[model samples]
Target: MTTRRSTLKLLAAGSLPAMLAMPAARAQQPLLRQLAIVVAFPAGGATDAVARLVADGLRGKYAETVIVENRVGGGGRIGAVHVKNAPADGSVMLFGPAFPMAIFPHIYKTLPYDPLTDFVPVATTSKGAFALSVGPAVPASVRSMADFVAWTKANPDKATFGAPPGGGQHFAGALFAKQAGIPLQMVPYKGGAPSVVDVLGGHIASVVTPLPEVLQHVKDGKLRMLATTTERRSPFTPEVPTMKELGWDVVFQDWSGFLAPARTPADVVARANAAIKEAVASPKVAAALQAQGTDVDINSPADFARLHRQTWERYRDVVRSTGFKAED
Candidate 1:
């Protein structure tokens, strides 16, 4: 072995420095060489937006290559089944809405996979509260939730709100009406984005949808946000009160989580959870998600699993209350 003086000279020669840095470089290596984040919807939708941002955040950090693969079909069932059949490694994860786990079984008579058994919770990526926003169809005077209620009572025929069929918006609207004791009408749309189109054109009085889909219009004064369905005020629109805050029992919030195929090793699950938390907690990533009205509500595996179970049970009642019978 070289003496201390010789070691110092070797360091000065850059040989020892290079050798020492190798461990650090290796330690910094990403957990996976490739990670496929599967989104059930097509590109450019709100869910896809969340998936893309997360994939970008994971790049060079969680995995050397992170890609969002859109596996659209069967109202998210196709992608769910795809991920369920994927390898039980950390190489693939499903980044989709909580509906497939929490709501689908109630709606569909036969699902390709058992959500409870086919996947294990990885972590929650984002949460969004549904909002009731009024457009020009309602009098400009109707600004607050109370005002909207009174207006609907006054003009019973015009108390319609555009909502997608059999989704969070539809259920949130139904639950809100039941709690508020108002008989608001629902004008169905194929999707959340299209539902806002009619409300924007003043074809419908308002639209109950995820806040992100209508946030811009509300900010632009094209649509006035009356209330959100979350238990608390939304972080994106803190000034707007929630239905619960306004004395209505309407408390509904939507969240998206990542799930890996069942039997993924516990260690792999833990590491994936850590990676997602770090990736989402990054300031830039958090800001971008917030800008899209998606809160980076990172959840630990255990916490997420608990929440999933609660939602799964809660929606079973909620769906029954709505009296919606799916044909398929």
Candidate 2:
């Protein structure tokens, strides 16, 4: 409303302050902000720890502020639902172990969210094996799976393997027993740590636990690792044989990855996948993951998608073969 002279006078009289308050160029802004990696388990658990490590890896790469959110309930359903409905802008993702995506669909009577349809596979951060370790209850001469089976047949009442019920390890033990044609029983423990304790104390004949759980004990000769459930030998224990090599088709893995809500743009998914793979390839992340008994399992988006689908189907078939059911 003012003349040019009046505008000039106003600009001279503190217009610099108003100019300084304006935003900078868009290029200065982070590609994404407030990025969240939603974990289905509580904090302090292995899943949450993996998520946090990845979140740390993602900082300054994926977003300016990356956070790992714990949404624990309904056996990972709450976080699944949350991620399923999150904005498809790639700002929010569900970061969790493979079971929530691969096993839950076959185990639960119904899930609030469809893992296959509701999310797009990102990249797995890491993958590790489940192992079979024996305690003193088994004869020291029982070194291989064949020897263990023979001993189990002779000591049928004492042939029990401990693992958490309804977990992949439990099913792996069941499959091993079926394959070996031995009458073996499964003892459920609250967690692998306790189960490892029982195995070490000779309270249980053997245990099906994650490979890392017994690495040190095996190294110290406190326990003996008979076989791993991985399709191949674990890098952490390359000297150990796999159950498959020992004539049992038992294969199980612990994998962690992220899945974006369905309909997220393909480019965004690719970008996220590449970024995550870079984070995984970083020396810090790789070293830490290796220390935890996980391998650098990052791959291209297409490859990861294939792996994701196959793992889901594998768990479905495994659960079906086992006749496992969830309470309605």
Instruction: Give me the candidate number with maximum lDDT.
Output: 1
Off by over 4 Å in 1: 1-31, 150-158
lDDT, candidate 1, residue 188? Answer: 76
Q: Per-residue lDDT tens digits of candidate 1, residues 1-328?
A: 6689988898889799877788999756456889999988767667887888888878887788999998977767888999999999899999977777888888878889988889999999888878999998999988788888899899999999886555677788988887788879889765566677888898999898888888888889899998898888887899999889788777878678899999999988998898888888889889888898887788999999999888899888998887878657
Q: What's the lDDT for candidate 1?
A: 0.84
Q: Give lDDT: candidate 2, residue 322.
A: 73
Question: lDDT of each prediction vs. the true structure?
Answer: 0.84, 0.82
Maximum-TM-score candidate: 1
What would the per-residue lDDT of candidate 2 be over residues 1-328, giving only the tens digit for each residue?
A: 6678876876889685565455665324356977999987656545666677788888998898999898977657788899999999999999876777788888878778787889998888878678889999888998887888889999999999997666677889988888788998999765566788889999999998777678778999989998998888887899999988877778787677889999999888988997898888888978877877777677676777888888888888998887777745
What C-alpha lDDT, on a 0 to 100 scale, does residue 326 get in candidate 1? Answer: 61
As a TM-score, model 1 comes out at 0.82
**What is the overall TM-score of model 2 with all chains considered together?**
0.77
